[model samples]
Target: MISFINVDCTFGKKAGIKNVNFTINSGDFVFLTGPSGAGKSTILRLIYMDLFPEKGKVSIRNFDSSTIRNHEIPFLRRRVGMIFQDFNLLQDRDVYENVALSLYVSHYKTREIKNRVYEVLNQVGLGHRVHFYPSELSGGEQQRVAVARAIVKEPVVLLADEPTGNLDPRVSLELINLLNKINQRGTAIIVATHNYALIPRIPNARLFQMEEGEVTKIT
Candidate 1:
């Protein structure tokens, strides 16, 4: 459902990618593995349209980076979920409210929003943490909150940018397993991580090993 055709995007002093080409079908589990400045996160940003390619194009189902308008980006984002190394939860908002905000922005009804927020929180094993705030939860629990927030929209593809960067190994594995379960349910997953150790934990996942600013290997 996603395709990157000879995509080349450059920005800042170190954040960029070059000639990156790949296709991720629905329900596929893919990993972008490389060093600190390997451009993994840039790829994810391109997928969600937070970054645009200067050369070639990124195509995600209906949206194309080269031709997409400003107004259409929001619709593309609703179909693409994102998680980050830092759990980006609002300290002022409780877990339930944080998860509900996306649906609220999408104009889902109050009842539907409540039901979906609860459903995805439960799916991420955080059902009881609904009333908890970001500071009250552990690092792992907070990340689970982020996961819940991302999936509440039932996105077509989920992009995780070093999602386990702050968690311990065990909690990281648990998070990966949770993501695996979500993928099995038919949402494609693309994780941008530097941890090569995580690759073995995921079965049958495609590996896109990047170097400098290019995809040097895919296994």
Candidate 2:
């Protein structure tokens, strides 16, 4: 569902990513692994259109980056879910409201929005925390809320950047399992992380290695 063809991204005449090419099919769970400064986050940014390549092309569900218009970004983003390590939730909003915000902005009917919110909240094991604010929950619980928010819209692809970065190993494993379950339900998942221990647990996952701005399928 996603492809990068000889893509190159440069910032201030310096290379950010070089000749990176890869394809992720629907229903696949992939891991993007590399050391610090290896362009892993750059790849995710490219996929999310936060940064466009200077050369070559990025295609998502057959929509080429060059051909995509600015007005189409909101629509495109709605089709892809992103989970960040920092748990980017609004502290003032309750968990349900945070997840519901996406659907509301997309103009989903109020009844449908509530149903979607409840479904994903239950999926993330955060249904009981629906009325809790981000600051009121534990780190793991907050991340769960973030996950619910990401999937509430039922995005076709899920891009996660260091999703377990701040969590303990046990919680990290739980999060990985949650992601696996989501992928099993057919949402393509790409997790950018340096945690190799999680890979052994996910036997069927594909691994992508990045170094010096180049990415390759190493496993």
lDDT winner? 1
Q: lDDT tens string, model 1, 1-219? A: 999999999986544998889889997999998998889889998999999998898999999999999999999998999999999999999999999998888899999999998889889999888999999999999999998888888899999999999999999999999999999999999999987778898878999999998999888
Worst 10 residues of 1 by lDDT: 11-20
Backbone collisions counted per model:
0, 0
TM-scores, all candidates, are 0.97, 0.98
lDDT of each: 0.92, 0.89
Q: lDDT by residue for model 2 over 1-219, one digit each (tens)?
A: 899999999888777889988889998899999888788889888888888989999989956789999888887888889999999999889998999997888899999998898889899998788899888998889888888888887888999999999999999999999999999999999999998889887888999988888885556
Error of 1 at 99 (Å): 0.1
